[model samples]
Target: MRTLTELLTITKNGRGRLVLVSAEEFFRLKSRDRRAVQPAELSDAELDLIAKAGMPVECAALDAEMKGYAL
Candidate 1:
């Protein structure tokens, strides 16, 4: 089996280096996070801040379109 480092694709961007991984690997890494927080447990201020935050216009448009494909 290939090492994680060997399987990754690294690229340079203006901000910093970005690492690309397969969607399977991405979800595998995400699932390993044991410190996930419940939104309901957040304070009112935190919840308000989250609710007030806006997605980028491009992302908002894409999100609207993606709603149609949701299971």
Candidate 2:
């Protein structure tokens, strides 16, 4: 995916689960851990996406990621 928004769309399509490696995404599997994090481990909103999404789950994840990032 070229952007975070696109990554989110993938998650929405995946029914709230996404494998993020080739793009900017909300990662269920950390590169270091090689372990899978449960959907319930995510924020309530992250777990709420429908298969046919009105918006991307990556948006919410990106927003959360931005909280700790600097320009």
Model 2 pairs whose backbones collide: none
C-alpha lDDT (0 to 100) for residue 21 of candidate 1: 69
Candidate 1: regions farther than 4 A off? 1-34, 64-67
Error of 1 at 36 (Å): 1.2
* Model 1 Cα lDDT, one tens digit per residue, 1-71: 66553455465675447677667778888999878589988899999999899888777667767876957
| Model 2 weakest lDDT span, ten residues long | 22-31
lDDT of 2 by residue, 1-71 (tens): 25553443345654857544433333533444666688768676666653336646757766766786788
TM-score between model 1 and native: 0.38
- All models, RMSD in angstroms: 12.0, 19.1
After the best TM-score superposition of candidate 2, give how far the Cα of residue 47 lies from its true spot, in angstroms.
0.7
Please provide TM-scores, in order, for all candidate models, with all chains considered together. 0.38, 0.20
What lDDT is obtained when candidate 1 is compared to the true structure? 0.75
> Total backbone clashes of model 1?
0
